[model samples]
Each structure stands twice: as C-alpha cells, then as structure tokens.
Target: MTKLYASLALGLLAAACGGGGGSAPIATENASAPAPVAAAPAAAPPADSTIDCPMFPASAIFNTRIDDTARFPVHADNAAWQELVGRATPFTANWGTSSNPSDLQDYWGMPFNVVDAAATQWPLVSFDYAASGLVFEASYPAQSDCASSADGSGVVRGCTQVPASQRRFPFPSGTTLAEGGDCGGPSGCGDRHVLVVDKAACRLWEAFYAHRIAGQWYAVATASWDLRSNAMRPDGWGAADAAGLPITPLLAKANEAASGEIRHALRVTFRDAALSLQHVWPARFAAGSDNPGAIPFGSLLRLRADFAIPDAWSPQAKAVARAAQRYGLYVADNGADLHVQGAPDSAWDPAVWQQLRSITMADMEFVDTGAITRDARFAKDSLQAGW
Candidate 1:
C-alpha cells in the first residue's frame, strides 16, 4: 500500500488546495489578469420535487442559485440521475461486509482539539480552505513556452487558453501557476498538485499528479471550472480526482459551518477501498477488487432524509448533519471509514466538533447510480453562451 500520508494527499489536497492535493500559499501577487467572463445562469431548480432530492438552492461555490428549472442533461433533470435517489444500502465497513482483520487508520478518528488546529501545524486536508491559501490561490495561469520534456515533468509550462471543450472559462494569458503540494513542507506541501485561479475572471484550474521541479508546475491531468456555473465534471472524466468530480464544491468550508448549515454534499474517504484506478461516471478510478459489493470511488452516500438531528448538537454538528441528509457525502479517496471532512477553524469548539463522530454509516444509505456514466464529454454549447 502507498504511504497513508501519500494516499491521503490527493483528496486532502484537493480539499485544501484547488481541485486536489495539499495546502499551499495561494499566490497573492497578480501575475496576469483574465478578461471578465459573465457568470453562467444558475440551473433552474426542478419544479418536480420528486426529482430534487437535495434542494441546493444556490451554487455553493459561486453564491448563485442554480436554476433547477432548466434541464441539465448531465444530472439535474436527467432521468438516470433521478433514478439513483433513495437507493438504499447499509454502510459497510470499508464499503464491504467481509469483516476482515483491518488495520487502517481513519483521519477523522481523532476528536476535534485545539492542538489539532494550531496555526503552526499543517491543517488536516479537511480543514484547508481558500482564505488561508490552504485550498486555492486566486491567480492566473502562467504564459510561457513548453518544452517537449515539460509535458510529463510536472513543471509549469506557462498558461495557454485551454480548449473550450476542456475548460468552462476563458483562461487569460500570463497567469502564474505551479504543480504539487507538501502538507509537511513549505507553502505548497504534501502530494503533487496544480492550481490556477483567475480572480478577475472568477475561475479555477486544477490538476492531480501535479509536480514542481525547478520552480515550474506540471501535471498528468488538469481541469478548469467556472465559479459561477453549477457545472459538473463530465460523466467519465477524472478531474484531478479519481472520482472525476470537482472537490471544492463538496468541502465543508468554515463559512458553511458558521452558517449553521452545509448546503452541499461533503467528501469522505475509506481505507484503501477503491475499486480500481480507472473509474466509472462521477469516478475516474477503476475497481479495487472484483467484489461487486465494494463501494466505488465517487459513490454518493447520503444520510437518510428522515433521520432526525438532535437539538443538543452544536451548530457545526447540525450543519454537517443537514448536508449529509440533503446533499450526501461523496467518496473521494481511500482512507478511514466514515470519515467526513471539515475545514480548519480555530473557533470551532473541539467538544462540539467531536459530536460529528456520533454520525455513522448506520445513518446513511448508498445512492444507487444507474446511468450516471451515460453522458459523453461535455460539449462547449452544453451550457449557456456566456459560460
């Protein structure tokens, strides 16, 4: 097995950094400004209450309500997407019921403690956020020439406008960017990653298996998303994540915690539990084993909608609970069973946060995903003209 820290670096980094990998200081200096791109209209919420399982009133990332009213061929109003709702399954240990002698570590096993959130220490992946540079660096991609050697070297080869089919926003020239993270090292620490944020344009770019050698960034895979749109990763493509999804939208940010409700689904991990390196729709990884019962990467596990929340629970705990019941949790990586993620915040009460452990697999059910992967690559015109 890979080092636990290494295995964790991917999911945690995405949560901490942009897309995936580890924490790092987002470049505060302006490298290149991007042209302003009008934000896409929110996907109109569906009038059919039956199809809208989790009522995400707005785009969790962009602060715009998705127009659930419009039909999203990808998921929102898709018949295949609706079919997965209420698909029930008891959460098994490691997503399987074998009950073998396992010795995996759960990152979320420890209760929240002040020491855990000490500023000097590297915040765990769950706690990393954009404000602190733990998550994203609001900058632009670099404008430089790429050598053939740079293609696979994990080095930043300068910023180029990504193809419309590949990117959701217009990438301006002269954006500064890099790859890789070092959770244990300086600003960008942990595993390899790539990050690009166009503040002026309100966009983000990221990649997995990112690298940096001699102050240059490189990556095996990269993706871009418009902050304003309720866009989703194409069904079968992995975006810096084995799950083929964006990590930022799924994180439990401090603001959300403070709001007394996490409006979106959160990310979770398991102990070396991936089905494979190549994934299914919503997942880009393959099956880890032949076990048909194993939970694949990107599988959505949701708390029963009918589950009741205790009034005694703290605001943070209740917020998390509400999200689980509403949006559910997405399996992002392999490590610790039933370990949900949370952003770092010194203000969080340790005792209150510990209550999150009270939540368990017993409270959730695996969402059935039947035709999740049916869609092909997203066409440039799939969204509105401005997006």
Candidate 2:
C-alpha cells in the first residue's frame, strides 16, 4: 500500500488559505475561487544567476535533499518498487578508465561539453522522433536549410516551435556525441546523446540519438531548459533521457566528488524488465515492461541512512555515498541494473571507483516524491514552490 504524506494536508491548507498567504504566487485567479487550479500548466519560477547553470532553483526537487523527511512526501509505490528491484543488487559506477588504464583518454561515461564562449556553428536539422507538441526555440540567424524528410526509421519530423532554441544546438563540426567516438552515424547506431551547458545563456540543451551527417546535426528527440526556471516538460514527453530529466545535473562529477560533497541526486538505470510502463511525477515518458508493481521511471532510490560510508574509503567514494543517503538517485534510463552515472575525468582514481561498487540495492530504499510534487500543476511538471 502507498504511504500518505503531510504534503497533501499542506496542499489542502495551501488551497484553503487561498494561497493568499504565501508570496510565491506562481499564478492566481480569483481568491474566492471554488476549487484549486485544475491540472493546468504552472508558471515557471523566474530565472536568475544565484545558482549555477544546469542546477534548477534551490527549491527544485532535483536539487533539494530528501533527507528532510518533513518537507518532502514519500511516494506511494516505494515498497513495491524495492520488492521488484531487489535489495541485494550491487550498484555500478558507470565512469572510469577500463582495459587501457595506461591510456588517459581511454575512459567510459558520456562526453559533456561546456560552452562559455564562441564556437563554430552547425545547422540544426529537423528531428526524426521528437515528442509531439513540445515547443523548441529556433536559431536566431536561421541555420542552413535542409529538406525535412524521413530518418533511418522512415519517420518524418520537423520543427514545431518557431522562436525557441535547441533545434539549433551549439556544436561545432566534428563534435563528439555522448558515449564518445566519431559521430557520423548516418543511420544511428547508439543513443549518441549530446549534452551542452550554455552558461552565458544559463540554458541546457540535450539531444538523443543525435547524428552528425555531412556537417549537419539531426536528432530523434531534444530538450532545452532554463537552468533558473522551474520549467518542466509536459506529461509523457521524452527528452535526452527516458525519464524526461536532464543528464548533466545528475552526474557525479570528479571535481565535485573530490571536493568531499555532492549536493544533488545522481542518476541511475535498471534493466527494462525491472521497470514499469507507468511513470511518476517529473517523468514524462514511460517505457519498459508493464509488470505489476514494477519500478517506474523517475523513482527515487536512496541509500539507507544507516548504511555507513566506510571511513577508510577515498573522499570521492565517500562523497557519492553521502549523496545517495541524502538527495538519493533517480531512475533515469534503461540499462544495467543499479548503474550509477558519473563524469569521467583523468582526475578520477579508479581505486576510489572500485570502492563504490560495494554499494548494492539492499542498502537503499525508495522515497515518495508525492509531497515534493504537490505544488506541480501539470502531470508533466515537477516544480515545487520554495519553502
């Protein structure tokens, strides 16, 4: 059975209070309105520079610490997911140097690009499998035009939003896609995700199954978000990841881990068979099997608070363990079970990564995100009003 949360009571009080009391009025109609706002799209939190790029507002769910049990609600399906996902499965760190430890460049994890200044421009070709109805901004000085046509899958796609970004990302010719290597996949072999953090614009752009062909780029789906805003994809829309979540923020970066603390949740993946076809708040698209009580996309899996981080472990490993206990992990994509995603760096000590492998699903539990999502006004949104 699902657990009840105080957040629902707070929602009632917030509604009964006409929400007139709080200053964070995302939107308001008549104060005496008979019912709370329908599941209408809520206004995004105003964007600003106080927080770094790729990190949403401090109040956002992704950045908030779930260790504060009072402020956030536990999801109803927590136990069900754990029973299905199992507690003894060991977690894997998906970043580090493999076979050729002598070769610094030989490592795993997706390649992420940071854009702080000028770069060569490449045309943003139409998508082959974008989530229908989502709007994307177009390039300012229009990109080189190409005939919109069928992709390798023979599915036709084109730009929908006329004045938005993302359809035109900031990759120079020959830029590598996610998972590395030359990105000239004319027919698409892998996910080939491309992630960019545009600090100047305080925006994040991500594309899935991206292909760089003949100096132009095309993708199956794309998502662009204002780092400062609480904007969320409409329910059931897919992005670079299946959970409709951003990829960069969830990664456990080497620099951040070496600093001794990672403040946000990390991303994890599971086999398709362990995933439920249904999704939870903030997760727009649902894929995988429809097994009853199976884990859903966007489920929060936290390291049990009692699980001690061995004192002898490297600071990097200890830091990740702490975050798993605090902010937790979000089921983001379909892949190996309990695979924890991280940023690959030369600075990473493979020994430290090896220590992290000791962590298993048995040391974790699911968090009910119901209360954190109470304020969200749309099925697709995960925005939460600031406390």
Candidate 3:
C-alpha cells in the first residue's frame, strides 16, 4: 500500500511540475492561435434515467456460494465498472483484521490489499438491468440434507418452493447460502425474495453483507419494498413492500432470523446518460484538486502509448520521470504568479493512469489561467510546431 501511494504521489507531483517523460499538455491556442484538434463528438446519453433517483429502490440477498469451478463472467456492458465509479464517494469506517474480532479501526486505515480484495469481488456477483436485479453466489459447508437431495445435483437448481413452515427458518442442510433480490420478484425469486422501492439507502446498506456465513454462503436472504410519501403515516415517505408484507414486520423477522452480519457487493446500472453524468463527473473534478482548474472540463485524455522510463536514469530520476508520464504536465499562468498543480504527494496514492487517460478534453474545461507574458522577450524566438 505504501509503495502504491508513493507511486501515485510521484505521478501527481510530475503532473504538477510538468515536463519530464509524460505526454505534453494539449497545446491551447492563444486568442490569436489556431485550433489544433477538432472538437470531439459528444458522449451518448445513458440508456436509462430513472436509476439516478437517490431514493430509488435497492435490495441485498444471499446466494449459494459455488466452488472455484463456478465462473462469474464480467458483464458484457461493463455495468460493474459504472457502478463502482459511481459509488466511489468517500466512505469512512473502522478497519479490522480479516477474521480477528477486536481489530476494528477507521475505514481508510485498512491495508490496500484488504480494500482491493473487496473491490475485486464486484464483478463476481451477477446483475440484470432489465429486471433491476442482483444475485450473489455464496457457499456453506456440505450437509446431510443437501447430499440427500441429489448428491449435489440439485444444489445449483433455481429457486426452490420452500413450504411456509420451511421458509420461516434457514434452509435445512446446505453448507453455503446465496441470496438475490430485485424490483420484480416473479423472475428473481418466488416466495423467498422481498421487494423494496424508493428506499435506495436501506437497500444499499443491507446489500453489503446479506450473504456469507462463516466466510461462505449458506442461504438466500431477500427483501423488497416500495418508497412512498404518506403524511398520514409515520416516518413520512418510506419503504412499504418486502416479499409481500409491510416493511416493519419484514425487518423484525429479518433481525430475529439472522445475526445481520452480511457482506454484499453492489452492481448498479446507469439507465440513462443523466445518471452517468451525475455520478461520474463530480468525482473526477474532486480528484483533480491538485491541478486546480487545469484539467479541461474535468475530462480525462487517453494516452497514445504507455509511458515508461529507461534504465539509464537513476532510481530517483526514474521515479520523477514515471510521475511525469502518468500525470501529464501543464504550464499555465496564474494572474499573480506561475503555479504548478498535480505534484506528487507523500500521502496520497496514484490512481490508475489508464482510467484517468480515458477522459477527453471536452469532458473537462479550463476554469482559470495562471499567468501569461505578452512581452516580446518572453515570447519564443520561432513558433514551435508542438508545445
């Protein structure tokens, strides 16, 4: 983690200092200067818009954990990427040992490996946008009843028809449990799933750990509800439906049935362009604080090639060069003095340059200029083809 942070800080510093090994900043024309690159086409709008509402419904459920043999492929549309980037808002919590009971500490205090471990799991869960659904695969130790069913033949079968008496308690003999919940229940789960609408926060909260028993999946835990404003009702507007019952009774039953110690990985889909913009742009703007207003319109530009430093440079020099490559430098004039942004930091880690590179100039805007000199002596002797 420290090494990663150091590497990132170097990139940031290089970007701030400008000019080492990274791609040169896009040359902007002075008022009299001619334009270089043509304006890029606008990005297409997202496919859905309703998913952007803050109060939109969400759910968390457990699923049957599969062995390493069960493969979970990446979503064809890269919805996982969108969800992660959208939800990358700063979160603070205590860090703790993987299994040790009393090792809790602040969230960011945890090692990067721990954070990465959890993040990598995002794509492991399955998602369906048309149905607004999510499913997790979990595993529990093998049990006698599970073996009796069909010698593991029926384990992967779709949702079972649990009787009313059997539904009230945990599944009889599976070692693992997997859960799923969606806006529409008939397609996601029959009697086992609960539905919730307009309660986005609660759904997000519960989904974090609705699956996993002793580090495995044992059974599916599901919920569904409707979010509505009711002046006549307490708590104002809140969730209403879950697997068919009102929210209150469902929650009480959930608490009594399980310890509520569940971990979940959420995969959100952008229904339309509006939601994508709302979720992605602000984060980029905030991250560019080091460069201040230098990043154009908060757009990230892809690099033509991966920048690398040759072995000829000393380690320290190589570090500087690497930073320069990862974070392109900008030479801007502030009104009072020349200042540099994106300097490497000792505290912060460098994010993937590739991701940053994917942004374009149109996505960013030049909010301010630092300083410029009009004196002939300060001007270049001859016009340089590229800056």
Candidate 4:
C-alpha cells in the first residue's frame, strides 16, 4: 500500500509539476498580460573579468558553509540525519540500472555544458522583438508555470507581465535549439530547457519544457537568478529543474576548470522514488519516493577530505576531486543514480572525464546537515514577489 500510494503521488506530481516528457504547441498569441519595457542592459563587467564566472559571492548558497548561515533550518548533527546516510543505498557510476548511463558524459549531456559563443553556431532557434517577439509572463506561487493550474496539467500556456531584463533572456544572439523538446525522442523528449545569461546584467534565466512559437518564448517553468546573491529558491517550489534548484551555480564552470578546482558542490540526480520528502536546506523540495531509504533532496555527499587525487589525474580532474573533498556534491534531482554535472567544454580530456567515474559513492560520506524543520514564513520570504 505504501508503494502504491507513492506511485500514485508520483504520477500526480509529474502532471502537476510539468515533468520532462510532455509538450504543447507554441501559441502565437499570449493568454496573459504584456511585459514591461526592456530595462537597460546591465553594466558590462570589467575587461579582465567574466560576468557570470570568475567570482561567486561568498554569500551565494553554493559557496556558503552549511554551518555558517542563520537560515540553516536543519540540525546537522542529529542522530536521524546520521542514520539516514548510513542506511540509505549508495549509487555510483557503474550501478547496473537500465537508466543509469555507463559514462559520466552521457548523464548530463546537453542539460548543461558551455555552448560556443558564436552566434551562427547557437542551435536553439532564436527570435527577436522585430521578428516573432518574445513574451514575459509573471508566474505566481499558485498559478506557476511549473505547477498545476485550476484546470489541469499545470503548464504555463500564455504570457504575463515579465521584464525584458528578466525574460528578454540574452540567449546567445545566434543560439539555436541545442537538443530538446521537439528535437528529442518521444519518451525521452528532453525538457527542451532554455538558458539565457544576461552578461551585462549578471543574471541568468532558465526554463523547462520550453518552446518558441511565432518568435515568442514559452515555458512550463522558469527561474531567474542574480549572479551576486546567495539567495535560494523557495521551499516546495520547482525551478527549471525538478530539484527546485538553480542550474548554473551548481555546474562545473569554465573558469573553475581553468582554475583547476571546483569550489562548490556538483549537482547530481537520482531516479524517481529514490528521493525523499524532506529536502535539506539549500534545496526546496523533499521530492517523494517509495524507497524508505532514499536520500533526501539537498543531501550533501562528500568525498573524504583527505582522499588523495591519483598522480596520473589531469589538473582539471583533480580540481573536481578537490571540490568533492571540500564543498561536496548536492543531490538536486531525480534522474540516473549519482551522475555529477558539468558544462560542456571541448577542452575536456576524454581520459580526464572518464576518471570521474572512478570516484564512486563509496568514497563519500553524507555530511551531518542537522535535522529538517519546516517554516512557512521562511518559505514565503524566499519567493520572488513576482516571477
């Protein structure tokens, strides 16, 4: 009966939350209010600096120590927390599951990876104000693009009042559909995620189940982030990804690759029913599963701090290993078991990439993150006044 209830909840949750498999045709006309005038492009970063990379504010949730914040709602050293990690099944690269990819590269693939800056090479189709113009709709907590509407299948179908600074996502001017949505297979129809970085503004916009019709952008869910703050997504809300987490901050950035170490945790995935209802802080969902031993979303899995990086490893791989030992990896979504995320970069060595598979779940320990506590007021405060 427990398994049966979880199964039903899973099905209902998917429909309510805009699961990756479905799609609706783009609408030429918007069903919501119009967007505001475009804000001036954000001030460009200094010549020597990159806007989004290079510097992550100390306050950013990714960079913040779990023990440092007054907002940490969980009691990290609780016995329950320790027991959770000790008993929960651990998955690594070679887990013999049908959905688990054999290689680390295949797991994240296009969901993230650096795209070439060249305009013509951008694969996702692009539209401008002069052409099929884009639309911005303000999403509400109850009437969210990713949540169920009063009707059904809570997908955002129309446009509302969104700002150009927020919605006029500076997708690479020549960005084309990389691979997703209509471009992917029926069962595996990718989320058709659209990510736009306003370098000048130092902001990021990401969407899931995205589509462009008559030049207008549409999405089932969207999220925006300020590159400067360590703010978190509201509890119980969904972001472009199912984890209700930000994707860019979690990614292995090009700058980090160049610096030879990732300072933050890598975003990872678990198959459905392998997640729990109690998300650790920094994560917004306690994505439910039938497995009693499933790790809660936002749980931190760290490689032993003193673990040695093999001498044969490349500098880039070592940096990643160092990060695992330091900041650790955070469970962000439901997908394959233990797949770490990094943006695509041609510079990656195939051998270096493969070495990541060597660092399995066994080499890691679940950090003591205290105990889980729910505060409705805190959850509301984390939300944007308007999306």
The best candidate in terms of lDDT:
2
TM-score of structure candidate 3:
0.18
Q: What's the candidate order when arranged by decreasing TM-score?
A: 2, 4, 1, 3
Return the TM-score for each candidate structure: 0.50, 0.72, 0.18, 0.61
Question: lDDT for each of the candidates?
Answer: 0.40, 0.60, 0.20, 0.47
**318-362 per-residue lDDT for model 2 (tens digits):** 989999888889888788889999766777777776798788777
lDDT of 1 by residue, 1-387 (tens): 113223434543343343545543322112353322334445433211222311222423212212221221122222332232222222221211111112112121211111111112111111112334333422222211111121111122232332211222111223222211122323433324443333333344554444333333333345555444544433434454555555545556444566686656677766553333334334543323333435567666666655788888778667777777666677776555666644333445454545665555555566543322232422322222222
Which stretches of candidate 1 lie above 4 Å from their native place?
1-197, 209-213, 230-236, 274-280, 284-291, 369-387
Kindly indicate the candidate among 1 and 3 with the higher TM-score.
1
TM-score of 2: 0.72
Who wins the TM-score comparison? 2
Residue pairs of candidate 2 with colliding backbone atoms: 74-368, 75-368, 87-362, 137-164, 137-165, 138-164, 235-380, 236-284
**Model 3 score (lDDT):** 0.20
What lDDT does candidate 4 reach at residue 131? 39
For model 3, residues 242-340, the per-residue Cα lDDT tens digits are 111122211111111122221111111111211221111101111111332122221111111233334543333333223222222221111111111
Give the per-residue lDDT of model 4 (tens digit) for 123-203: 222222133344332222221222122111222322233222233333444433332313432134454556654454344
Model 3 poorest 10 in a row by lDDT: 229-238
Error of 4 at 366 (Å): 1.0
